[model samples]
Target: GAGVSQSPSNKVTEKGKDVELRCDPISGHTALYWYRQSLGQGLEFLIYFQGNSAPDKSGLPSDRFSAERTGGSVSTLTIQRTQQEDSAVYLCASSTRTITGAVEAFFGQGTRLTVV
Candidate 1:
């Protein structure tokens, strides 16, 4: 059983470049979520995928941010035209979709993106 995994534990990028961060959720988990937590800030939900459909994308800051999950497992957050304000820890989490209230998200260490 594997937990969520994210690549480029640290990333330094220019102010206007596109970046793609990868996430591999735990096996058999049907729910995936992406969140952004800036320095000294709370987590902000970016997108959510329950199975193949993303029911919520309201947390995306702007047109530059997008995410997609395939086969209900792996997900990627793509930031187009990175900005300095976008520098934050991108976290990925997954949980089993249960009718009970016991479902909890297991988060990855997160990809720390630094925009310069």
Candidate 2:
């Protein structure tokens, strides 16, 4: 893909139902991240996958949310037993790692999830 791509721009689901969000990062990018933003809250880090290293899942809000990046490319975020508080815009970003320091990251339009 030319840039980070996410599916299901909008989602409306009943409480307790599970939802799966998908992301396709740019080619050659080694780092991918998942973030959550509420109505007024800042981007909350959820997870990170870099190359072949183990994913950094420290930022996940709870065990109900989990993500995985396969073959160092596409990624998926799954939320189980969704709750009303889970309603928000889920954002995905991908960046090319450089030797010196941080590099620019490309973000997807995000998936707006409304838990009814």
Candidate 3:
């Protein structure tokens, strides 16, 4: 993909149900990140994947939240037993190194999940 891509832009699920969000990062990008944004709230870092391994999982809100990246490209975020408070926009991003050694990340449009 030319940029990060997220699936099912909008989702409505009942409380206690589980939801899976998918993301496809740009080709050859080694760094991937997952974030959450609530209405009128700032972006909350959920997870960070460097290549096929995740070095930072502490940002996950709880055990019910988990994420994984395969082959350093695609990533998935899963939320179990969803609650109304879980409703928010989930975002994915990919970072790549430039010639100057600076890393810049490209972000997806985000998936909006509404728990009813």
Q: Cα deviation in Å at residue 39, candidate 2?
A: 0.9
lDDT of 2 by residue, 30-59 (tens): 999999999988999999899745458899
Give every collision pair in model 3: none
lDDT of 1 by residue, 16-95 (tens): 99999999999998888999999999999999989878989899999999888888778999999999999999999888
Overall local distance difference test of candidate 3: 0.93
**CA lDDT of every candidate:** 0.91, 0.92, 0.93
Model 3, 22-44: lDDT tens digits are 99999999889999999999999
Where does candidate 3 have its weakest 10-residue lDDT segment?
A: 96-105
When 1 and 2 are scored with lDDT, the better candidate is: 2
Model 2 misplaced regions, further than 4 Å:
none
> Candidate 1, 40: how far from true, in Å?
1.2
